[model samples]
Target: MTRSPFTRRTVLASSAVLASSTALAACGGGGDEGGDTAEKIENPDENINPEGLPIVEEEITISFMSRRSNASAEDWNEVAAAQTTQELTNIEVDWGLVNEEAAIERRNLLLTSGDYPEVFYRTGVPSGDIAKYGEQGTFIPLNDLIEKYMPNLTARMEEYPALRTGLTFPDGNIYSLPGIYDPTSLGLRYQTKFWIRQDWLDQFGMATPETLEEYQAYLEEVAASIEGSIPLGGQDMGSILTSLYGTFGLANHGNDAGLIDLDADGKVRYFPASEEYRDLLSFLAGLYSKGLLQQDIFATDAAAFSANGTEGLLGSCGVQTPSGYFGKEGDNYVALKPLVRNAGDEPAWHAVRSELSSIGNFVMTDKSEHPIEIARWMDFWFGEEGAKLFFLGVEGESYEEVDGRDELIPELLEDKTVDEALKPYVLYLGGWYPGWATDDWFRGVETSEQSTEGSKVVEPYALKEVWPAFTFTAEESQQITTIGNDISKYAEESLAAFVTGDRSLDEWDDHVATFEQIGLADFVAAHQTAYERRS
Candidate 1:
């Protein structure tokens, strides 16, 4: 496959175009007022082919706007996925690719100027805007199109009802499509796990920790025995919270801003304001006081954490894979099952990800001339054949079947990582595209033996029922945004202070009270409404 060269100059040029269009964007934008009716172009019956390749008898080009990461080809025409799709579908796309960083700004400019492209692909339109634009006529609804033309997507919706519930707005219209992952894929089921130094455990003749008390004892032993070692290496504040708080029954999910989850009764509860959260904080503070935890955790990032592990200074850490930290030394680490408060008690909470992403990946604008053909083209990505093409690129060239399994060419992996080698062929690595990601394909092609084994260790403890992506009414969305932002900021700051012993636990009541004053109840109520609507 031929690859197109991408340069820093290309990125700067795209940013320049977005910067120049800001004035026009400021002139007009979405508001309470309804938008203009979408212009309709009658379908040419003779040119349409409903179910198979070559959607249209004659090739027709339509405008498509999408974001491109730095790893992607400079020209979409040269991308193997784009080239092969065009060849098979006979639907030429006039690509309007923008840098990933500037895509949202450019999209907003086009939307406000009333000159948006015919389609938006993988631009990650926010749920609020999906509802806002769908209510207005700016984004044409795809309910009928999906039911009539997209068999693959319709079948998926039937299988996973959450896809329909999450994508549908308050008006009962579907305006966007999402990238769906196989529900059983362990890699996508959970995000992070508690990884510990197996070498240290072996040297000390200690077993894997199972309970909160045992875990703390292990950390204290490591701190006392290993010189200059951080018994529990620091991660980002959110990751640290996510890795530990579940022992106290708080479901953090690694999203500091959206720290709300359903309780045992399936009701919306703000975790940061709960008694369980206070207990978790006190536990962390105790660890900090003993020097068992990293002192500069608030400032520590992934790079710093990895450095500690690489230097053999971390006894344990919370991360997806140790390869990201210790490189070839990752085999010395082992993933631990979620700890419990006491032996024989089950772990109450485990982090999970929604199969359907929160952000919409594909949408049709009012200006499209061939809605049916476009819907069919978009739906192709959901099917098995098209999914393989989009994810693995053209067969035999980018990947080949060996022993009844698809694998990348061995020569491509000699010097470059799997990601680096596939940049010239595949459009996306594992995400940011609207399609169905299967466990077989992802595990076979994208993951390593180490990652797969780590996933297996923690899969049994994962949450069986997770909250699906919820869609709020536009009014509810605005209210949540206005109030939730302040709550999130204040909560994060308070958490850091309390953990570091800068703030005494006696003032915990005052901190909880402040959340109430910041409209925490209202913020939670809006989420509850959305959750109930999904039911």
Candidate 2:
């Protein structure tokens, strides 16, 4: 294989190379001995020469990897290479960016082969993976190191129980320092928002459809049958159709703990077997036959979806997120209002879901020679200052103070696009919508006037309920993980069959049964258990 000079993450499940193999193997142990790997300090007064850190002039390389979407590791890619390094810690970094596909392969090869770097950057192993490796003696336990060094990181972990919980594994020993951000984000960015094209509605002289039945009537007319614009556009990954289920008052479609919600009193039943799901199917099926359904709904990516939303192609369609749909037109789409009930029936929308992380499952490798150093750097990124540097660029250059606040001053770029002056300098937060991570990251990156001028605006029609069933527990995690993998595959297949009209609602019973047979109950139980535990 031609290995990209990027992250080499190939999954190799071999033994983690450890120093004491015979004794450890004889003892039949793979859990943390919970002992510090640092040389034991017989007396802190004598042995703890904790006075100084390595100076910037005394250079050492930190070879870390990220599962990089961009693929190439440029010279300026190192987090510490920016001006803030000299300003804060005075540490110079050598960048070794790696590709993710071979991440596991290299990780296994290094740990088993025993030629790992002094510091493993972006090892690409999960917490469970950490536990497995730590138990194997491939990873050093971080309990004492965290206590002795990393006071700033320790302060935040002590403050947030969740942070500590995330870092510490099954045996009460810390493995990897978590890539922490604010536990509570401003709000859930990944949400379902139903968007209607103001232009299409205006062309038809139609008032915004409020109820599901009314919307259906509109969609049917627009379905290219009765003579309006194409009423729907479909994409598989996007959950616009999921809104059909949401209209029936189901919150997160994927659930465990119990599919049957206990009311303020109490109740029990399964969701897939519910009448709401049935109605959703029947209505969608009807739309499909009428040619009102989106043909490419199952295949479209986010870019395609955004094109439709921005281009005003349909009368109304499914979009769980409103931000992209709203701007450009600027308050044109009545995005935040409640949809009316279908016919004379009740109107219900899914509870607003929160707690979606920017990245799923940040990982660490077992080849860390300086776990404390690595953890310290990661913890700083989670803290107030590090968060600022990562999100916003150096102060004054990117932004200015205004009315007791830091906000971006609008600057036209060379391309003549209207972007904040700071945007080019500040490292982008992958795909996360702006103002996420640290609100403090905004400080001095912009002027108050500019910040206030460019403040976020949401459609008035957005949903208004909190669905707290977000986080999953360890036991529940095992089940959810299993089901999630299967569910995605099954969902794709089932949705395809339905969209093609090869399968009808007549076979809905069989479909539900199939899902259950594939461990739907276990999945639901896990999510429910996690929800209750976290709550």
Candidate 3:
């Protein structure tokens, strides 16, 4: 079988080194920052109580380490919602904020430096890191704490069993708090999609492409009519193709190493090892060979993709949302409905699983001065009052309740945008879910007519069975990392090469064999084990 055009040997070697080195670095240390020698600090406060109100009227302070936008004028303390939280909880926070760009590095450094904050909020801690540190007692398990003090969180877990299942580690311990969004499918049901220039369609009296043939024909016409145009392009062609892979009955859950996902019947199937993947490669290859798609699809960076789209030089693109890549100026581009080559095929497009909650939002360390008090403060976020405060703002000021519905006034959005105005009054930090983000909140805050229309177009084709979020055993985690990194690299390189005709599909058998040689079976099995555990 023909292997991917890239060197798998080099990639595997590099991955092995990185995994080994990082593991060593994480494990080897001395004193406070060192791995085994770092003594876990026990909270000495004897009067701690987590279940009651006014956690501490005596003005206790806790230090937090989290990311702050380098561009925004707002700091954690300056956000109105956080200020109100301080007043309500009677807790002052010493914010140890770092620029967003350096957040991960800074977080790692702080973790290893012996001197760390009491709490980590929206810290982006990886599952591996959480498992590693939690086992070492660097971070304490919150399972008991939640049952004792977090009524809101506990209730939410009871309502959504998956929320608790997703967050629980293999050891049956909960180490982090989660952010729960409102339970609505409208906002959370889809992922990235293809966007096309509607103006070009209108100019040529053409309708949006509905089938693979139609899309290919449209691309040909666009290329023929427009000067120096790329009919199809993407910021990351590999990722774009992966997202669209489901249109051919092969789905990828973006972050996973194994392109294997459970079918409706719960059978494990790997995309790269299937005939559907070949059909996709051939279709894309035909496009590249015909000059209907960008020749340098894989080489093009995000800047170039945006530049082409913004300048109206490209006919279509696959993006997370039109607004993110094209802005309002590229508003002429409309989202494309899922297309199929044949009549009987399912139009399974990329849809991110609807989220009721986000895991790993916050974590408490053993070094915390008052774990119980902090737990109480964090638990407030899950309550009705706290949810309203975080999602909406002060009643009558930011929004008003009419007929028992929270309605936001348009005038409130007139002076400063919803996010801007709400910046001072709430946490509003990315990735931190304080619960209660409703459809109304979306409509009030950032929803535009174009976005609403686009959502409608793409919603029907959303894929149903996505890979659920699950934690891995430490051993399984390392194996997935090393094997997955190499396999994904090979798969991406091979797919791109096949599409571009740099490598022929005639060698496809050899390519499949290469995966086996590189431990594809082991990778798939690891994912299967995790999937079954979650189920």
RMSD of each: 8.5, 8.6, 4.5
Model 3 spans with C-alpha error above 4 angstroms? 1-53, 71-74, 181-185, 252-258, 263-266, 301-303, 323-329, 354-358, 384-426, 429-436, 442-448
Query: Estimated TM-score per prediction?
Result: 0.89, 0.68, 0.83
The candidate scoring highest on TM-score is 1
Best by lDDT: 1
Q: What TM-score does model 1 achieve against the real structure?
A: 0.89
Q: Per-model C-alpha lDDT, please?
A: 0.75, 0.47, 0.69
Return the number of clashes found in candidate 3: 10
| Least accurate 10 contiguous residues by lDDT in model 3 | 33-42
lDDT of 1 by residue, 395-490 (tens): 887889999988778887788876777777777653567888765565332145665577788777666666556677666665676666667777
The runs of at least 3 residues in candidate 2 whose Cα sits more than 4 Å from the true structure, single-residue gaps closed, are: 1-61, 71-73, 76-83, 100-131, 134-192, 221-228, 234-237, 241-245, 252-275, 317-331, 338-353, 356-366, 402-405, 416-424, 427-484, 521-535
Residue 344 lDDT (model 1): 90
> What is candidate 2's lDDT per residue for 40-95, written digit by digit as tens?
32123232224233222343344554333232223344433245643454344443
Error of 3 at 240 (Å): 3.1
RMSD of 2: 8.6
- Return the TM-score for candidate 2, rounded to 2 decimals: 0.68
